[model samples]
Target: MTIKAGDALPQTTFMIPGDSGPEPRTAEALFKGRTVALFSVPGAFTPTCSARHLPGFIEQAGALKAAGVDLIACTAVNDAFVMGAWSRAAGAEGITMLADGNGDFVRALGLEMDGSKFGLGMRGKRFSMLVEDGVVKILNVEEPGAFEVSSADYLLGQL
Candidate 1:
């Protein structure tokens, strides 16, 4: 089912590009006892994702932290290497990059989208949420081909 307010996030593993290499991080490890501002993009380095979606979070990360968020995280269906590269290329210092390389996390939340029309395969939908202690407090899922409610500004406003 699509994860909603009050729903506990599903158990899944995400890859993070560690100092040595890709490291596995469990959902519980990331969310437990933390107020996380989590956002997902269709893929890393895509037009809108690179230009706006990710940058918006990177730009407003401090404001989010000031608003009581403990962590700012970004996720995508891309692998850890891509996520790491994107983080570096965008200078996303404060954001945690969570790599759902196989779309397992998004699929568990019923948020996967078909991107085959653009030569891309299945991918995660563009969305953002406030997760507190592993439960969802707020969710903003963008409509197909739209980038409205899922922006960092919108989430900050909600906070």
Candidate 2:
């Protein structure tokens, strides 16, 4: 089932390109004690994700932070290498790019969507959540091909 407002975020390992290489971090470690703005895209570098999803968060990182978001993070069903590259290419230094390489995290949250028809295989659905100190305070899950509720501006308005 999809995680909703008031659900504790599931603990799952997400890969991050560390200085030494890819590193494993549990969701609890990232969200605990922080007001996090976590957004997930179907895939990194895809047309909609590249052109809109990632850029919207990157462009409004400052505003998001000012609205009391301790950290802004972007997650995708891509590997660490791809996520790191996409972050760099998109000028997303202000946001934490997480690699959910195995689709474990999305599945754990029950947000996985079939993208096989598009040659993309399984992927995360477009969504965003406000997680405060490890618990979800708000969730905006978009319909297929929709971006309205999951946008940074819309989430910021919620805060």
Candidate 3:
């Protein structure tokens, strides 16, 4: 089932770009004791994701932190190298890039989307959630082809 408020996040491994190469980070390791503002895009560097979605989080990182968020993280079904490049290109200094390279995380959350029509394969839907101590406090999932609910500004308002 799709994860929702009050649900604990599924255990999964995400790749983060490390100095040497992609490094594995488990969901438990990342969220066990932290309040995290996490967002997911269909893919890294895609139009809406690149121009707006990811940037919104980057722009609101400080506000989110001030609102009791310990970390701001972005995830996509892309590899760590691509996520790292996108982060650097977008000047996302404070946002953590979590790479769901094989779609394990999203699949486990039941948030995977089919993007074959756009030449993209299985990908995560656009969504954001407030997770504290590995439990979801809020979840905002966007409609297909829509960007209204999952923006950082919207999430900030909810906070």
Name the best candidate (by lDDT). 1
How do the residues 46-109 of candidate 2 rate in per-residue lDDT, one tens digit apiece? 9989998889998899999999999999999999999998988999988898899999999999
Error of 1 at 39 (Å): 0.2
lDDT of 1 by residue, 17-75 (tens): 78888999999999999999999999999999999999999899989999999999999
Could you tell me every candidate's TM-score relative to the true structure?
Answer: 0.99, 0.98, 0.98
RMSD of each: 0.5, 0.7, 0.6
Off by over 4 Å in 3: none
Worst 10 residues of 2 by lDDT: 16-25
Better of 1 and 2 by TM-score: 1
What overall lDDT goes with each candidate model? 0.96, 0.93, 0.95
Minimal lDDT window, size 10, model 3: 54-63
Write out the backbone clash pairs for model 3.
Answer: none
Higher lDDT: candidate 2 or 3? 3
Clashes of each: 0, 0, 0
Q: Model 1's lDDT to the true fold?
A: 0.96
In candidate 1 the C-alpha lDDT for residue 5 amounts to 95
Residues 1-159, candidate 3: write the lDDT tens digits: 898899999998999988999999999999999999999999998999999999899889889999999999999999999999999999998999999999999999999999999999999999999999999999999999999999999999999
